[model samples]
Target chain A: MTYLNKIKIFVLVFMFILFTSSINAQWNIPADAKNKKPPIDPTHTLVKTGKDLYKSNCASCHGTPGQGNNIAAIGATDLGTADYQHSHSSGQTFFQVEQGNGGMPSFREKFSSDEKWCLIFYIKSFDKDFEISGEELKEQKADLRLSLVEKIRTVKAYATTKDKSGKEIPLEGAEVQFFIKRMFGNMQIGELVPTDNKGMASIKIPENIPGDEEGKLNLLVKFKDTDTYGKVIKSKTIKWGSKLKIVNITDKREMWGSLHRVPLWVLFSYFGMTIGVWLVIGYVVFQIIRLKKL
Target chain B: MSEVNKEGTKKTIGTIVSDLTRPIKNHKGFTIWILFLLTVMGVGMMAYVDQLANGLGVTAMRDYISWGLYISSFIFFIATALVGMLISAVLGLIGIKWITPIARIAEMIALGFAMWAGLIIIFDMGRPDRALNLFIHGRLQSPILWDVTVVTTYIAISVLLYLLPLIPDMPFLKKAMTDQAKWKQKIYKILSFGFEGRPEQYKSIKKLIRILAILIIPVALAIHTVTSWLFAMTPRIGWDSTIFGPYYVTGAFVAGGAAVMIAMFVLSRNYNLKDYITDFHFDKMGKLLVLLMLVYFYFNINEYIVPGYKMKAGDDHHILGLFTGHYAKMFWTVQLGGMIIPIILLLFRRMRKPLPSLFIGIAVIIGAFFKRYIITIPTLVHPHLPIQNVPEEFHSYWPNAWEWAITMMAIAGAVLIITILAKLFPIMPIWEVAHEEGITNEEMNKYVKES
Candidate 1:
């Protein structure tokens, strides 16, 4: 009894240490990085984009920020807590998110600088005490017109804001993002750019990307910061991409396919053996009836 | 073989038929046993009712341990059912006389378990209403389709093998069972098919039994082999081995042999047929059980040690789980207690006696049940992709009350079948037993009246 109790205590204590000591690997950022502020004041637009990005990148380890369901084995810290928010500055959080350590991978290439900042601020939004400084813009009624210059493979977007008088005027300095639609999610194309004084921005599509058999690709262009410019989107099909020839493995007759597509050998043998066995069984059963007749 | 009668007493045909058929008219014990079985079956039926009404939510099976106690019980029935073929086709074809008394018991077990083996799989389905989809959408390449094919064929052959032998014995059963229910007596008379001392019919019965036995060997082998294919066809670690067919087949014999031992002990004690199912038979069955266990154990070592020795990435977690991990207790107990310990105990002359062998049989049987459990549930629990993003309940499996009740119902249903067969007909084949004592066919033809 005492032996069992001692072992039980040891296990309980061991588990306690194990769980509590699930501290994340310490990150060391330069002192200057800790004190640096966000170039633009943090806004709800950035935070929302950051939350969406965080799901694809970090949720596997850190879990939903406030939900404490973070992977303990990986020693991921709950970033939504006040303690985490108060401890790390915007630059330090941005640097940590960009240059990760241990089990956490560097998202240096995966996100743009603004996206990294967006993520830091989004994580901060979960902590109520952390004050966000951005004055969110009032709703702007905007229309973004898109045109494709097929010869140059360049897509042009002209951003315009409508006045109360219903007159269109060029909307300057609008942040825009360009993307080509993929199966599960969108694939970002080119860098995030702002509209010029003429309220027009242009991006050249890559020449080698594969599209459907008709050499058509779906393109989507939207305002990067919805709070600043209001959420407006434009999408169109362009014929610039190379032809994609689809050859699915299931198209051919194979083992993993449905009945009609299964290999003929498998069908023949399976039924042949089945029929053969049933035939003999039928014969033996027939013999029983013949005996009855006699 | 002639030395089976330890008492060396010669019995006339009259006492033999009466002693064997006496239990048919009298089922005071039978009624209670059937009631007990029916109560279990009733509970299982209610559980099935609940499952049908509420959906598969009644079962504890999740995406992982989807094949739970129902499949385990189904496999266990197929395992026990294989013994009838082993005893009848293998040992009897070799001209073993001791099996004369035990052969019918083995066939009763075969017929009973085989019939219910067909039904037990239905309990596994939540949408049994959509079962036709299996036939409609079932692919030729799938092992599940082949499993369905072989099982029905096996049941058919087993019925023929079981009934063909009884054709010769039916005349005696018809006459002796006149005191039985009119329906039962009519069944016997119909079963006999007017074989009144016909020499040609006797010859035909022999040829037909041989033909059926020959047929059953492959179908019997295929019955379990195809069952093994159900597991082996999957690329899962524990079930992925090429040797699984022989491994499962050998394991089936061990379980079936032990079940037969249990049956032999029960019938001899309860029915007072010591002269028929003698200690000598138990002794022989003990030896057979040891041989079966050892062969199965050899396959066990091959199945486990080869993969265990390498501890290949996927195989390691699975092998370790069975060897010394979460499933270690079940694995070691099944291996050591079921096969090894029984093998060691049954080797002793005294342990091979009816009573001692019964306990060993019970142990092996319990071990066998868990052995199938170990084979089935553990493989799913230790799937290649780590169990993640699922509830904690999905981490392990324990059959809920409904599952256990339904599983008990399947087992009791099979036993109930054997019980009914035992009660309705002579436990021993009258014609065969009389012939074993060197009686000619002409004499056996009128022995019903002469006795």
Candidate 2:
């Protein structure tokens, strides 16, 4: 080949290497051992049962083999991988399956108890086991089962007003405030909760409200009357407990008027002055021009 | 001077008023009807003022039909003003002495209506207060700026053309006055600029008029060309065309000729000017109108036919709309009544007579207004994208009462300006008339006898 032909070949090869190297760099994965996981075989019966249960219910989102590769699982974790399973507990998975996570519909009423267990088993099969102590298992079981102390940290309120059908109306825009028991305990922990547009308010107990051993918190929740000045129309109290959850506090008196106002005099005066000044200036100019012409 | 001979000399205001009222007293029916029409038009103007105060929403024009009757009237005014340049400037340069008698009238009409066009454009703007922005932020690239520049130039030149020859006539007017008010005397003195009709002043005035007459022709063409570019520059399907500039100039001449004919008919009959503006002038104007109409028709064919034949995808909706769709009636009426009918009417010798030609002129003027409306509105209705997310009212345009009232006010305002100008200055060019009679005694006597 001629020297010119060799130069042309070298340039073509250089361009091909540059393009392929850029494409490879974009698709490169980290070589960390922690990030890598052995794939699970679907032929295992336990895995197969989990896959069947998931397909019948969760596969629409979690995908076959719990890969979380389904269309609905976009922006969600890939469940078939071991890395994701290690971070979550069996109890947390069961709760998520029963209550549903963001964008995932709840299977609480849809699946039987055995089917949920099978789904959980399939999810677990993706991870290699780590040690679990007796104390940790007891703590996990205790947290899974909702007790009175565990339930105390949550509260739910509903709107009492309704149409002619007498069904509870969704109350939105109601303000809910919580106050501590001690004297001069006026410091507010959180901002006021304006009820949702549907007129429902939910308040969760703060975790720092010292455990039961630290002198019981005398908690008081009052529905603030928006129309009246400094008025507390409705009040509720929860005695010494780890936390308190009040559900459905629906009273007609709990509904309050809005706290929005616009002063009329200020609006009118501002506009009036602007228009008056313009008219006077215009008139004066016209007179001056007329006089000059005359 | 020369015993102020009433028959062959200037008449006093009292004598002129007596002479003018004598015909009115004898013809009460015609006088009363004219008075009644003037009253109605005045009332319409009062209603229009109410519209200006309230806003354009008083009219049927929604956003879709933004430039409605107001825009049409503006186009009509600009088109009419073209006649002044065509007659005074173009014919004067060519040395057509026959057009001299009516040159002042054409110039006055052009001056009055061109000024009115500027006012009407401001009135059409949603934010009339922002009209000064057209100058302040004016982009040379914009056709609107070009329009503003050319129109301002045209108006200035037209006013100068209308005023220049009046220098010699001003002394005649000043001396002829019997009960002239103080302000009127002052105005006449100032306007006359101490014109003594000296040889130098006369020569200077003639030179000035000649310069202006030469300058006004291209400015006249530019004004209409820029006005057409306001639409043609847009991306709208019907409006984007290379032929629009010359097409618009031809239409301007057609409309301008019609306007001149109408003005001549009205002023001659009302002012008893039959001797000055005779059947011969009408015959000449009729022939000019025919020529202009033919030229305009040829441009119209180029404007509408080729794109219409190709039926380009973008233009299909707009073309179909004009051809046999929603705008068919207006398109046919304007094309036929404005161009074809006037051409045919003016073609016949008998129809070129004053009465028939006057009717044709009126038809042409009204048709031209609708032609402008068709030009502006249909293209807006069919923009590049499909109309969406807007109220149903935005899809179509019809001028509301306010638009109609304001449009009428603009027309009345133009007429009012012409009337006021005619009152101040002689509608006929007095100096030109006297010059045509001759500068020497024996020649003047022969001219008197010949007439």
Model 1 lDDT per residue over B115-184, tens place: 8888888878888888888899998888888888888888888877778888887878877877667888
CAPRI verdict (incorrect, acceptable, medium, high) for model 2: incorrect
For candidate 2, what is the recovered fraction of reference interface contacts? 0.00
For residues A155-241, write the lDDT of model 2, one tens digit per residue: 555434444566655545656665556556643436677667755556666765542443356555545543221343333344433
- Please compute DockQ, using alpha carbons, for every candidate against the native two-chain complex: 0.43, 0.01
Give the B-chain TM-score of model 2: 0.88
Off by over 4 Å in 2: A1-67, A71-294, B1-53, B179-185, B440-451
lDDT of 1 by residue, A139-251 (tens): 78777999988889899999999878889988888878899988899999999878988789899999988889988889999998676577787999998879999888887
- Looking at model 2, residue A52 earns an lDDT score of 62
Specify the poorest-scoring 10-residue window by lDDT in model 1 chain A. A16-25
List fnat per candidate, in order: 0.73, 0.00
